[model samples]
Target chain A: MFNWKLLKTIYLYDGTLNGLFTIAFDCYIFKSIPSNIIFEDNYISNFLDTAIYIKTDNEKSSRIWNGLYNNVSYDTLYNCYYAFLSCQKNKEINILKYILKAFIDGPKINTMLHIDYVLEVMKLRKNVLHESHRLKGLTRLSEINKNLFYASIHPDNNVIELLGHFFIKRFPLQNLILHDKNRNLLFLYNSQNPNNYEIISSPSNFNISNYSIEEIEFQNLWKTFFKNISIKERTNPRLQMQYMPKKYWQNLTELK
Target chain B: MDIQEKLEILSDAAKYDASCSSSGSNRKNSSNGIGNGDISGICHSWGADGRCISLLKILMTNCCMYDCKYCINRRTNAVPRATFTPREIADLTIGFYKRNYIEGLFLSSAVIKSADYTTELMIQAITILRNEYNFHGYIHAKTIPGSSQELIDQLGKLVDRMSVNIELPSNDSLKLLAPDKSKLDIVKPMSYISNKLENNQRLLSTFSKKRNFSLSPVTKYQKEKFVPAGQTTQMIIGATPETDLKIIKLSESLYNTMKLKRVYYSAYVSINKDSCLPTLDKPPLLRENRLYQADWLLRFYGFHADELLEEKHPNFNTFLDPKCDWALRNIDKFPVEINKASYSMLLRVPGIGVISAKRIITARRSFSLNFENLKKLGVVLKRARYFITCNGKYFDKISSFNPSFINENLLMLEKRSTPSKNNYSQLSLFENSLPTKGDVIKCLTGNF
Candidate 1:
């Protein structure tokens, strides 16, 4: 019999969902527990512990995913997917433990909030969903040219991938690009291909300074309207900051 | 005047209306239009007052024909007046909509010339946006009281939501403060829009049922809706001598009789000084906040007006929230067992809201819940600990069930959370302490 409890090891992956799931597959095959799961780029050497790099495998990851689907509910599977996309610390290992526990306990593990791993995964999913929803409303698009519009956001989580479906369906006749400055990523949508959106790496020297001739005037009008609409008698800066935090003010037009 | 100056004067004048919501409409962009509506509503930004700026709330014109006592844009007030042509209004809305600065337009007017003429101008602007620009976004149009029923019907078909301000709560107050307007004028348009909306819903339901039974391809835009988001009304708080009980009773009737979507309460900021208006150092914001809490209880928490207030206790307690107050008044109903209580009973608890109650229902189905499980399920343990029991066991810290004991602890918690110097001042034997402007403002805005 394999003594899985005695063998504690560290795992490294290429920061992809398939790679993460491959680690889960290897753990169950070798009957060993991961002490930590670190991204390949962020990994540092520790001489006292054993570490192994897990390559991404398509068949093994899909097999593990199919197993989870048959055992757990769709909401549980999606929660794991969303939580994995979060930039939280030690999220990969936390998600791995959650999936392993789900396989043993079945779908009821989702409602077992008393379990620490289950609750952590649920919290991470909620955090990512909340930021994506807020950005949907807070994204301020500017007319970069006659046919193109642009918006820039610096969110705390990896949420830009979640906004494409909403914006594409809402603006089917317009071309727009949503840029995530912190992650150096771009979500580009064109009117010709309204049904599809493309994600690309943002160039470091992207020019955002060139605006259409009438853009400045409209921006000024928006700022004026924003200023005059607030009642002076009920100016609660604390409440305002609570709703739109100070960190998001850098990209908002009216706040600047 | 330039568009910049016109927008400034008009939006400033329209600021006191106090209705900024842009939700509850599910209109879609079916015809390759420029915009669509979200059913849950999206707030694009927060104002300095912490109000959601969901729409570009502006007026067609600030030129008024009536001299109401409490209005900033009354005939006699010497504020700058401006009017936007229909073309300018349409252009501004599309520009703002394309850039995502607003969800849509909130078009109101100040009875320029007459009600019919003002409604005509608003209809023209909306017509241009809907037909000419092919914009399908949310539009909330304020119906001018006493406008012709035909004009009201026309305006209703083009907008997502409509409202007519009651201005004052009581007939006597209306007669004294706004002599030119009457209660019948406001109610006539409100009932007209209400009946029209009901008929629209009936027609749409039958149409949908027929289409569902027969699977011929049916377009989504089969019928033109009449105020798809329904209608709402507003009344100025502290403008009249009506008690909170009277106001709440009126709101309950409006929700029942008129089938109104929302009833907004605006704290009367004393912008215009008149003998008919109550003289205040600032607006009664605490009273307004209390009224909103009571309003929520009426709408969502399955509460009646009389259950919250009585003739003797005609107002809400300034420090305690309405739900906590009600829970304490009927203490026998509480200390509800978490595992055995029904969903509605759980909602009656102090800290368990609709979401938490539903969560409890879901979480309890798998395993019997304990206090630790309850906290993880998003119940505010600080407040719910006093009212609920886990597995027939009360919280460990709560030694007594005396109402006064619980009240004292809750008050202490409230004070600790909102520690304000103005609310608790040290008195001196020899010197007199007058309220500074800052203290007065804090007291008015309900910071404590």
Candidate 2:
């Protein structure tokens, strides 16, 4: 085993899966793990830190991807992918350590929750998937034109891609554009091509105005139903806040 | 009435039902369909009362033929009434479904003219949604207690789940409160649903085995299931004097015999002041909560009704949950070895739930866990610390295994944990006094 502590190398990448996997490929070739992995845009130089900017290569990334598929379990692979989607600090290194540990310990590494890095990786995955599931239920779509719908969300994690697959299946005949305002990413889907979706970057202030007249009417109807459905005798706002947090209330039509 | 006024009356009429679950169905969307069923139900929003808004819960109409005393829209009560045309119901379901405001529609109604008539109206609304709109989302419909078997069967084939509310616990209470409904009226639909679901299961297995059978029509309908998620029912609590033990036993029997998906206990909110009903300042919310806890024990925790409460102890202790109460009474099962205990044994501990028990089992396979690791595994160490042993070592905070002593400590823990003030109430303008020293001390100690 190479002594990673003596080298103290910090690898920088472009914050993409291919970029991170290429770094993983380089670590195996050099027989030494980097002391830390930092996204290139967020890197801060220091006198003691030796940062290496590894160029992302498709050949090298595919090699590591094939290695992981052949070695680790399917859950471990997906956990690595979802944990990478989380914007939590130091998640990249934890995911790397988890992947490397899975390679060494086989599929049983997921059960080893006692390990610190494995638990952190699992928690990151849980956090991202939880946000994705919440936004799937909470994302409100409004009709913009005749057959087109639009929804805007500000989720904590980059989960617009995940929600695109879900809404496409549920509304296969309707055109949809899901906006992630925080990440400035948009998921566009057309009813004609139900199988394909596009994630493109746009400005955060790109708001869709002129909602259909029926849209406002339905929003009022929903708010009225939301108000009347609750029993006044058993009003418990604390429990409601616990399930639907105040931070997510801005995107909800009824709460608004 | 206008549509908005009708929605106000109908939705207000339907709010008493506590069954809002959209789960247990796996219906997929056909091509060009507008919606699909999610096996794990999704809640788009929560109401102010903290219940999930998974389905558009509204009655087809608030006009009733019967005079149930606890009902808000009974025949004798002078309340505003409204009904929705089948087309309006279909349009509302599709509109709300498109906006992701609800998973699907939960259509219930008061008996307008006859049981068969109401059931036929409900079937008409769902038919428009299914055939005309091609909506495949979750639909839970209530079966009128005395509806014919043929009508119930047709309704079941269209909706995802069917329910018949056993509005009262006992036959005596049914007679006292609901004069028009009989015990036979409720049980007939329940048993019919139970037998039909069973027969569907049998047919499903046999038909799948013989794929080349000449029954082309049967093969065509193989995709559609008869009440695919099965049936659930609701019962009103605290309307009449029924012991907690009797309620639990009834729920247990319903699960075993009727094959129910769930049994919802609705706390009887006094809608109309009647001579037969008890006048309460608030609904029996705590008792209803305790019964739901006991119901969970019967369904998931491998617990029986007799194990939870005996004939002498007919009700639950208000301070402790049923699991903790059971654990304290069965104290011999204490200090279960965390490293070696079975999953079911781990679940019996006060603070360890199903998820934590599974976590402990999976985690212990790699390493022997200690107290610190138990907390990380999501065990409520405050409660489980009294009952569990980490590698043969008891939690150091407790000194005695005596049942009474542990019981007193657990009670104290419960008392300390419950909030002294209702935090979600409306702000009072008249009572604007500052807190005194005594009040501050009480607030700090959770004793008011």
Which RMSD values do the candidates have, in order? 5.3, 3.7
Model 2: what TM-score? 0.94
Clash totals, every prediction = 0, 0
Assess chain B of each prediction and give its TM-score.
Answer: 0.92, 0.92
Mind giving the per-residue lDDT tens digits that candidate 1 earns over B1-448? 8999999998888888788888898787853778888898888899999888989899999989998899999999999989999999999999988888889999999998889999999999999999998888999999998899999989988999999999799999999999999999999999988898888877777777787676642343334668989899999999899999999999999999999999999999988888888888788998988889888888887889998988999988988888888889999897899999988788788877888898898888878998888877778887778888888888887875668878877887788888886766667887887889998998998654
Model 1 score (lDDT):
0.87
| Error in Å for residue B285 of model 1 | 0.8
Residue A98's C-alpha lDDT in candidate 2?
80
**Model-by-model DockQ, in order:** 0.70, 0.81
lDDT by residue (B344-404, candidate 2, tens digit) is 8988988888889998998999998998887776577888888888878888867656678
User: What is the fraction of true interface contacts found in candidate 2?
Assistant: 0.83
Error of 2 at B364 (Å): 0.9
Estimate TM-scores for all models: 0.91, 0.94
